[model samples]
Every structure is written in C-alpha cells, then in structure tokens.
Target: MLYIIDILGTIAFAISGALVAFDKRMDVFGIFIIAFVTAVGGGTLRDLLIGHTPVGWMNDLTYTYVIIVSTIFAIGFRSKLNYLRTSLLLFDAIGIGLYTLIGLEKGVELHLHPILCIALGTMTACFGGVIRDILCNEIPVVFRRETIYATCCILGGVMYFALGVLPLDHNIVFLASGTIIIATRLLAVRFKIALPNIYRD
Candidate 1:
C-alpha cells in the first residue's frame, strides 16, 4: 500500500511540476528538470535528514521512469486538458497527502519523536513544490501564509498521531489521515480559506 501511494505521489508531483514548467514557458529539458525535482525533492530531503543513505529514487530506476512518463503525459495532454487551476490544486493536494503519510511512517520506523515525525511529514510534502516554485522564479506556495499548503500536511500528521490512539486498523488510520489532508486542501482552495497574514503596513 505504501509503495502504491509513493508511486502515485510521484506521478502527481511530476505532473504538477510539468504543468508549472509549461506555464512558465520552459523548454522540454526544463519541463523534465522541474518534474524530476518536484517528484523527488521532498523525499530526498526527508531521507537525508533521517540519515538514510542513497535515497529511495537512487536505489530504483522505476521512480525515474514514472517521472519521465508523467512529465510526458502532462505536456502531451496540456492542449486537450482543461488546464484548469483546480486540476493542479487537486494533483498537488494528492501528492502532499500521500507524502505526508509516507514521511510520518518513516519517522515512526526510525523511532523519531512525534514532533519530528510531523516536521518530516511537512518537509516531505512541501519541499518538492518549494524547489519547483523557486526554480520557476515564483514564491514557494508553502511559504505563503495564505496558501494553506504545508499547514495541511502538519494537520494531517497530527491527525495520524491522533488516530493512532484509536483501536482502528493501521490501514484505516493512514487512509483517514491522508484523506483528511487531501480534503482539507481541496476545501481550502474551494473556499479560499487560509491563515491570516501577519504582515502589516
């Protein structure tokens, strides 16, 4: 199940990255570059912080293949697709949702503290988009208070721990947490919900 989620998350992130690249009018190479980084950037950071050597993608070429295929799919279908902002939001939300669960599980396996686990989850979910935006010369959405991006990951991570105390099955717990994360993001976007800005003139 985790493997499936990881693959799906990679695909979603790769597509989202490719979309951003196209929106920026980048070339083919640039599209692939952005897709690659967005798909693996967060996971790489999580692995390094956890002292894991030779990140997951480095150990397997399947991830690379998936990213390439996803990039192509994104670019190939751009014209046929609606190119709606909501589509991008949905894909990004799904990627972050799965990534949050994956990161939280890894932290638990590594015997990390709950707080650290939450942090790892947030990093795993948001770092990829952060790098993508930076490379595209835009502000990282997660860094924006109004984005409600990383906050979704953090809330989902917290929900994971909360659900852990229940007598539900582990699979159910993970699914519920991830679903909540995705739903939160979609709702936030639909309702234009966000944290209040702290900056004042």
Candidate 2:
C-alpha cells in the first residue's frame, strides 16, 4: 500500500513538472529532466538527510520508470491539461500529501523524534517543487507567502503523530493525515487563503 502511494505521488509530481515545462515551452529533454527531478528530488533529499545510502531512485527503478511514463502521458495530453486550468495545482497538492506520509514513515522507521519526523515530512513534500522552481527560474511556491503550501504538510505531519496514540489502524491514520494535507492545500487555493504579506508597500 505504501509502495502504491509512493508511485502515485511520483506520477502526480511528474505530471506537475511536465505541465510546468510545457508552460515554459521546454523541449522534450527539458520536460523529462524537470519531471524526473520533481518526482524524486524531495525523496532524495530526505534519504540523504537521514544517511540512507544510494538514495531511493538509485535502489528502485520503479520511480524512474513511473516518472518517464508520467511525463510522456502529460505531454501527450498537454492540451487537455491546459484546458483543466487547475490540473497543476491539483497534482501538486496530491503529490505533497502522499510524499508527506512517505517521509514520515521513513523517519519513524529510523526511530527519529516526532518533531524531526514532521520536518522530514515537510521537506519530502516541498523540496521537489523547490528544486523544480529553481531549475525553471521561478521562486518556489512554498517559499511564497501567497499560499500556505508547506504548512499543510507540517499540519498533516502533526495530525499523523497526534493520531498515533489512537486505536485506529495505521492505514487509516495515513489516509486521514494525507487527506488533511491535500484538502488544506485545495481549500487554501480555493479561498485565496495565505499568510500575511510581510513586505508592506
């Protein structure tokens, strides 16, 4: 189940990255490169932070394959995606939610502190987009106060640990936490919710 979720997350981020590349009028190689990094950059950073050797994609070809397929699919359906208007945001939200859990699980496996686990979750969920934006020559959304991006991941992580003491199954806990993250992001976008702008005119 975790493996499935990870794959889905990878696909989501890959598609999002491909869409961004399309918006930038990038070539096929650039599209593939952007999708690949956006799918695995966050997880790679998380693994390295925890001293997990060889990283994740190096150990599993599945992620690379999935990203390749996802990028191709996105490019094939670029017209349909452009019509959706919110496709990029939707996929990004879903990607962060799923990756948040993947990172939290990794931290837990290493018996890390809960706070550190939450930090890992946020990093795993946001760093990919950060890398993507940097490569694309745009400021990362999570760094912008225009929306509460990474905060959603942090809240989801908090909720995950909060539910840890409950009698619910671990899968249920994951679903609930991930849902919180996804829903929070969607709602924030829907309502134009954001942290106050620090730079006053």
Candidate 3:
C-alpha cells in the first residue's frame, strides 16, 4: 500500500505540473520536464538531506516512467480538468499527504531525532512544489503566510508522532497521518483559513 500511495501521489503531482506547463503555454518537452521535477523534487531533497546517496529516482526509473506517462495522460485529458477548477490544488494536497509519510518513515529508519523527522516529513511533502513554482517564475506558495500550505504538513507530522504511542496499527497511523495532511489543506482552502498576512499592514 505504501507503494500504491506513492505512485498515486506521483501521478497527482505530475498532472499538476503538466497543468501548470499548459497554463504557461509551454511545449511538450517543457511540460514533461516540469512534471518530472514536480513529481521527484521533494523526495530527492529529502533523500539528499538525510544522506541517502544518489537519491531515489537516480537509481530507479520507475518514478521517471510514471511521471512521463502521467504528463502525457494529463495533457491529453486536460479539458476535463479545466472544468474541475481546483484540480491543481487537489492534486497538490494528495501529493503532500503521500510524500509526508515517505519522508517521515525514511527519517525514522535513519534514527534521526523525532522533531527533525517531522521537519523532513514536511519538506518531503512541500519542497517539490516550491521548486516547481520557482522554476516556473511564481512565488513559492509555502512561503506565503496566508496560504496554510506547508503548515498542514507540519501539523500532520506532529499528529503522526503524537499518534505513535497510541498502540494503533502502523498502517492505520500512516493512513490517518496522510488523511490529516490532506484534510487540513482541503479544509483550509474551503474555509479561506490561513495564517495572518504579514504584509497586510
């Protein structure tokens, strides 16, 4: 199941990147490049930060192929996505939920301090989109105080570790953690809930 969740997250981010490329009127290659970056950027950063040499996609082509296929499929079926209005945000939330667990578990395996593990988890869930926005010449959403983007991951990470001592099944913990991350994002958007704007004054 972890593998499946990872792939679904990959596909979601890939679609989001492709959609951004399409919005920017980029060519097919540009779309593919952005999609690939968005799909693997955060995980690669987490691996590097944790001293996992060569990173994940470097040794395995599975993620690469998934990104490629997802980009193509997203571009081909994009008209339907247009009608959804919030497709990009939705996909991004799903990506965050899945990637957080992957990073958290990797940190746990490396025996890092629990708080740093939570930081790693938040980075894994958000840094990809940060890179994506930077490359696309947009402000990184997580850097905005009013967005409540990465905070969802941070709060969800806290929840994950909080639940760790509860005697629940590990898989249940994982699912609940991911759900918390995703739900926070979705609900925040739904209610326009966000941190106070720093520049409002």
Candidate 4:
C-alpha cells in the first residue's frame, strides 16, 4: 500500500515538473531531468538525513522507470495537458499526503524523535517542489504567501502519528491522513486563504 502511494506521488510530482519544464520551453532532456528531480528530491533528502544508504530511487529501479514513463506520457500529451490544471492540483495534493506519511514512517523506523519525524514528513512532502522551483528559477510556491501547503502536510503527519497509536488498520490511517491533507489544501485554495507573511510586520 505504501509502495502504491509512493508511486502515485512520484507520477504526480513528475508531471508537475514536466509541466514547468514545458512552460519554460525546455528540451526533452531538460524536462526529464526536472521531472526526476521533482519526483525524488525530497525523498532522497529525507533518506540522506536519516542515513538511509543508497537513498530511495537509487535502490529501486522501478521508481526510475516510473518517472521516465510519467515524463514520456506528459510530453506526449502536452497539447492536451493544458486542461489538466485542476487534475494536477488533485494529484499534487495526493502526493503531498502520501509522501508525508511515508516520511514519518521512515523516520519512526529509524527511531527518530517524534518531532523530527514530523519535520521529516513535511520535508518529504514539500522539498521536492522546492527544488523544482529553484531549478526553474522561480520562488517556491510553498514558501510564498499562498494557501497552506507544507502546513497541511505537517498537520496530516501529526494526525497520522496520533491515529497510529490506536488499533486501527494501517490503510485506514493512510486514508485519513491523505484525506485531511487534500481537503485542507483544496479548502485553502478555494477560499484564497494564506498564512501571514513574516516580512509583513
């Protein structure tokens, strides 16, 4: 189940990265590079921080294959992809939720402190996009005054840990966490909500 979620998240993030590349009029190779980094950057960072050798995609060729396939599909459907804005947001939200949970689980497995686990989860969910934006020379949306992005991931991670103490099924916990993250993001966008800017004061 976790594997499936991770694959889905990778696909979504890859698509998003490809879209940005396309928007920038990048070449095919550039698009693929952006897609790969956006899909795996966060997880790789988390693994490195936790001392997980070989990282994730380094150990799993399937993840590499998935990102490649996703990039090809995105490129092939470029003309028709303009209508995918809403779909992209949905996929991104799902990715963020799944990544957050997976990061938390990995941190716990490493015997890290709970707070560190939550931090890792948020990083796992958000840092990929941060890298993507940086590479594309744009300020990361996650750091801007947009709707809650990383905050939603952090909240969902906390919820996941709290529910994990119960006798609930693991799938149930995943669903709950994913749902909360997605709903929070959607509602924030719908209402034009945003966190206060630190520089404002």
Candidate 5:
C-alpha cells in the first residue's frame, strides 16, 4: 500500500511538472528535467536531511522509470488534460498528502522527534513544488496569496502523530492524514480560503 501511494504521488508530481513545462512552451528535454525534479525534489531533500545516502530515487530505478512513464503520459495527454484543472488539483493534493505521510513515517522510523518529523513531512510535501515553480520562473503558489498548501501538510502531519498513539492500524493513520490534507485543500479551493499575508506598506 505504501509503495502504491508512493508511485501515485510520483506520477502526480511528474504530471504537474510536465504541465508547467508545457505551459512555458519548453522543449522535450526541459519537460523531462522539470518532471524529474518535481517528482524527486522533496524526497531527495528529506533523504539528504536525514542523512540517507543516494536519496530515494537514486537508490531505486523503479522511481526513475515511474517518472519517465508519467512524463510521457502527461505529454501524450496534454491536449486532453488542458481542460481538467480540477483533476490536476486533485492529483496534486493527493501527492502532497502522500508525500507528507511518507516523510513523517521515515522520520519516525529514524527515531526523530515528532515535531521534527512534522517539519520533515511538510518539507517533503512542499519543496518539490517550490523547486518546480522556481525552475518554471514563477513564484511558488505555496508562498503566494492562495489557499493553504503547506499548512495542509503541517496539519495532516500533526494529525498523524496525534492518531499514532491510538490503537488504530498504521494504514488507517496514513489514510486519515492523507484524507485530511486533500479535503482541506479542496475545501480551501472551493471557498477561496487563504491565510493572511505579510506585506510592506
């Protein structure tokens, strides 16, 4: 189940990255680069911070293959997908949720503090999009005047930790966390909810 979630998250991120590239009218090589970075950027950062060598994607070729296949699919379906903004948001929300839980799980496995684990989870879920936006020459949506993005990951991570103490199945914890994050994001979008921004007068 964890493996399935990881693959789905990777594919979602890859598609989002490819979409960004397509929007920018980038070349094929550029599209692949964007897709690869978006798929692995967050996980790679988490691994590096946790002192895991070779990172996640570098240690496993399956991750690389998944990203490649995902990129191809995104490119092939670009025309059809152009009209599905909501579907793309759903995929992105799922990716964020899964990545958050995966990072938190890894941190817990390493015996890290819960607070630190939550931070790691948030970073793992958000930094990929940050890198993708930077490469695409756009301000990251997470940092802009938009609905809560990283906040959803943070809240989900906290919920996961809180639920971990319960006599619940591990999979249930993950599902709950993912569901909370995705639902929050969707609701935020639906209601145009947003956090207050700091601005210089």
Candidate 6:
C-alpha cells in the first residue's frame, strides 16, 4: 500500500512539474529535469536528513520510471490538461497528501518523536514544489501567505498521530489523514482561504 502511494505521489509531482515547465515554454530536456526533481526532491531531502543513504529513487528505479512516464503523459496531453486550468494545482495537492503519509510512516519506523515525524511529513510534502518553483524563478507557494500549502501537510500529520490512538486499522488512519490534507487544500483554494499577511497592506 505504501509503495502504491509512493508511486502515485511520484506521478502527481512529476505531472505537476511538467505542467509548470510547459507554462515556462521549456525544452523537452528541461521538462524532464523539472519533472524528475519535483517528483523526488522532497523524498531525497527527507532520506538525507534521516541518514537513509543513497536516497530512495537511487536505490529503486521505479520512481525514475514513473517520473519519466508521467512527464511524457503530461507533455503529450498538455492541451487537454491546460483546458482544466487547475490540473497542476490539483496534482500538487495530491502529491503532498500522499508524500506526507509516506514520510510520517518512515519516521514512525525509525522511532522518531511525533513532532519530528510531522516535520518530516511537511518537508516530504512541500520541498519538491519548493525546489521546482525556485528553479522556475518563482516564489514557492508554500512560502506564500495567499495559499495554505504546508499548513495542510502539518494538520494532516497531526491528524495521523491523533488517529493513531484510535483502535482503527493503520491503513484506515493513513487514508483518513491523506484525505484531510487533500480536502483541506481543495477547500482552501475554492474558498480563497489564506494566512494573515504580516506586512502592511
């Protein structure tokens, strides 16, 4: 189940990256590069921080293949995807939700503190997009006050631990947390929800 979620998350991030690359009118190689980094950037960072050597995609080629395939799909169907208007944002939300769960699970496996686990989850969920945005010369959405991005991941991570105390199955708890993250993001976007700006208007 975790493996499936990881693959799906990779696909989502890759597609999201491809869309961004397309918007920037990048070349094929640039599209693939952006897609690859956005797919595994967060996971790579998490692995390095946790001392998981060689990172994850380096150990397994499945993630690489998934990113390649996803990038191609997004590019090939760029017109159709662009018609949706919100496809990139949708995929990004899905990626973050799935990656958050994967990170939280890894932290638990290593017996890390709950707080650290949540931090790992947030990093796993947001850093990929951060890298993508930085490379694309845009401020990352996670750092913007106009959108509730990392907050969704943090709340989801907290919910994961909160649900852990229940007698529910682990998978159920996992799905619930993921759903919370995804739904929160969609709702936030729909409602124009945002954090208060610190600077004067």
Which regions of candidate 6 are displaced past 4 Å? 1-5, 84-89
**Candidate 6 lDDT, tens digit per residue, 144-191?**
877788899999999999999999998899889999999999999999
Model 4 per-residue lDDT tens digits across residues 1-201: 667867888888999999999988899999999999999999989999888878988887998899999999999998988798788878788888888988888988888888999899899989988999998999997888878999998889888888989999988987898789888988887887788767856
Candidate 5, which ten residues in sequence have the lowest lDDT sum?
Answer: 192-201
- State every prediction's TM-score relative to the real structure: 0.90, 0.89, 0.90, 0.91, 0.91, 0.89
Taken over the whole model, the C-alpha lDDT of each candidate is 0.87, 0.88, 0.85, 0.88, 0.88, 0.87
Candidate 6 CA-lDDT value: 0.87
Worst 10 residues of 4 by lDDT: 192-201
What residue pairs clash in candidate 3, if any at all?
A: none
In candidate 5, position 54 carries an lDDT of 79
lDDT of 3 by residue, 1-201 (tens): 667767878988888888878888899999999998888988889988878989989998999999988987888888887765576678678878888878888989988888988889888888888888888889986787665878889888888899998999998888898899999999998998888766757
Model 4 local distance difference test score: 0.88
Q: Which residue pairs collide in model 6, if any? A: none
> Pairs clashing in candidate 1?
none
Each candidate: RMSD: 2.0, 2.0, 2.0, 1.9, 1.9, 2.0
Model 1 lDDT on a 0 to 1 scale: 0.87
Off by over 4 Å in 4: 165-170, 197-201
Clashes of each: 0, 0, 0, 0, 0, 0
